[model samples]
Target: MERKTLITSTRNLAQLFATLEVKEASPQYSLDLAWPNSHNISVSIKRDDLLHPIISGNKWRKLKYSLAQILGSRTLHIVSFGGGFSNHLHALGFCCHRLNIRFTAIVRGDYSANPSPMLHDLQMWQTDIQYVNKITYQQRESPAYLTLLHQQYPNALIIPEGGSNKLALQGVAEIISELDQHYDYIIAPVASGGTLAGLIKATAHSATHILGIAALKGQGYLEEHVQALLPQTYQHWGICHDYHFGGYAKRSNELVDFCNDFYHQTRIEIEPIYSGKLMYAVKDLINRNYFNKGSRLLILHTGGLQGSRAIGQRASIL
Candidate 1:
């Protein structure tokens, strides 16, 4: 799609708002699995993965309020940061295209010579892509770099990397209201910590235990980041750093095999980067008898099926 083909009328913005307003909450399904222990434990999954084809799961949740702010403003462009296979940029590009706003991505590292599947999708959406070295990318959070970006795109709304902001947290917190019943445990995959932070804030007064399965290595820093996002200190949540398998975007044969077996049993496709690690941790914890009898677990499938293509290619080569 080209910029010329984008519809930039207020009518279109109104229609888009209406489209988002009427979207039904994603469904949650109970899973029937035989546990080794004799405890009466129930497991369920929230199908945020089926929320949308391109802009699915927490990606949509994180972007919903930001997109609304952009639509309400006079800014004609959107700017953000991401890596080669960032689902954040992928979803942002498509959202900008649909909203008739210009989109630019400050991509980490140089991937123009060999674009990943996500980069290809961004280009298809006509997102202006800019490459920056790792050293410069690290300066993304600095005021100097942010000022420079604002100078480049004068009337642009700049979103932080991973779309983790107050507005994004508000969007993720809505997941709490969509639940039909209370769960003893709420589990989700954690990368940049936005989703987990939202869950912690939402369940602050409840007895529910929020669990974050880290998807990257060296996740000790995630606690600080998540704490910085919240209004107050919360003690009802914990993060598991053991399920990453290797690191961000890194997969092992065990994770791949587990994903295949999970798909065969549940009929729900999961990629290794996010949902696979979450499901793996759930099963592992269950076998270890981490939960008591009659405990209910709710797993959030935060969607990243787009990354599965890369996993499939890697598996074939191995």
Candidate 2:
């Protein structure tokens, strides 16, 4: 059950306004939103015309700045990992076609005959989908796990899951270039920590505080994940290990009910994986008076809404 944000105000001062005009490299789309009081958080859906295109919002933001680094050959077989029905996979497939590049998506689960709508889109994008067992999928970042993939596909440009790596951080960090210094807080859900890490690192030593709502369960290891980009220096900022509904892709009835209540109140949909937990955490923090009332908090609505299908099946999709 997803509801969009109500754009009630005359104008929002906090949202990072995007170029809605489609261009040569990418097209533009906006997040249907209910503008927040502090600052409206939004992302542009860059509609790329080819395979491996970033169908997900900010997928373009995460990829735009890294194309040069990734441009080695005219035809490159790109590899990335995600669940059986990953938006990342779908986007990567479409994007690859656009660039005329060969693409491979190392998925976490067995190929489902009847996959989620998003996964079907990946197939439509002609993603060469490979399956890994659940246990092995859990260890994707481990050296041995990478070794296995490398042994099989040695030359593939394997992007880390959630696109959370140093290169990805470079892409995400470029977001602040268009922003002003008025925002007091920044909020985004922590997945593999690439986006969160980018935001925090970009704002390091600045007055603006960054908060990440964990969208996976038992993210105690996420600190190690984010810091993997930087070594041991800024460990304190990667402080979200809870609030992930349950691990990476699990949710409960309570969270579903919460999403419904949230929709009723705000008229905005919060996917079970990400924005749902973020809203839950942010509301709690607000009730506790976590920040100054007048200070602006920019909640980045990173679009992973594709995952909503599976959760919706469980929640009885509306």
Candidate 3:
């Protein structure tokens, strides 16, 4: 089953809405391990602490449960799809390097003459990069899409565009197990919707509200993605509606300045993509009294700070 019990502090406030409390089962989904096979090499950060360069948050979360299914018998060639400035790609590049695995990336959009600095750095990591038209790129989540990809590159361990899948979900859901079970809501950005969907699926109907902030503009389709993973019982979710500061990868100097100010205040680092939006909404909701004053809030840090390295490259160049 997907791990549980751990709750980030932002979740604490969400529990106050629990008309009733309950325990739910979010069993393990798929698995595909790709990491150090060196037996007896124990590390200090029991939680996927691959060298800091290899990464910290989403890398471990996306890999943990996926590794179990691989059975650890091969020199995995890790491959995934992403955009030019993708943090998932960055994490995959670094993680694959540390795990002694080959890495490949299928990125969407035309290649810029000077791509985001993050994309530039991944090249130095020796991750092979391929570009595809956006139409085919958007089809990445489909099983058929993956099958077609395998026909072309049959020997790679495939991760979806965002490292998004039931397996990656299982990995992230495991983070909940590390926290105290006293949260009212858990919020994350709605990207491919896998992370938010997995969270709600794992939490089930535990009375804890799962609120996903849509960084993508006009993301009503995320509701469709959530429905794909959850039962009708999850009809009572509290996914928030207004946080996109334009659209994915779109931002303003206001947000940039806000992030700097927010970091000074909370000592918490939230990337403009996910946690930053959550932080903005969380504070707003608290002020409007949607959240109880004394309630606790657990804002998940889905970790995409790497995208910030190339701030000058975003399209929302306001």
TM-scores of the models, in the given order?
0.91, 0.76, 0.75
Cα misplacement distance, residue 66 of candidate 3 (Å):
2.5
lDDT computed for candidate 2: 0.62
For residues 122-180, write the lDDT of model 1, one tens digit per residue.
89889999999999999988999999999989989999999998888988998999999
Q: How accurate is candidate 1 locally (lDDT)?
A: 0.85
| Best candidate according to lDDT | 1
In model 1, pairs of residues that clash are: none
lDDT of 3 by residue, 1-318 (tens): 223223422242233112112112122111121212312121111112222433445554665444333324353777788888887788777656555567888889867577777678778888888888989898887889889888877776787767667777776676567654556666667777777766777777476777787877755677887676554557546567687888887766776666666666544455677656766665566556675444445666566666766664223322
Which 10 residues in a row give candidate 2 its minimum summed lDDT?
8-17
Output candidate 3 Cα RMSD: 13.1
By TM-score, how accurate is candidate 2? 0.76
- Candidate 3 Cα lDDT to native: 0.61
Output the TM-score of candidate 3: 0.75
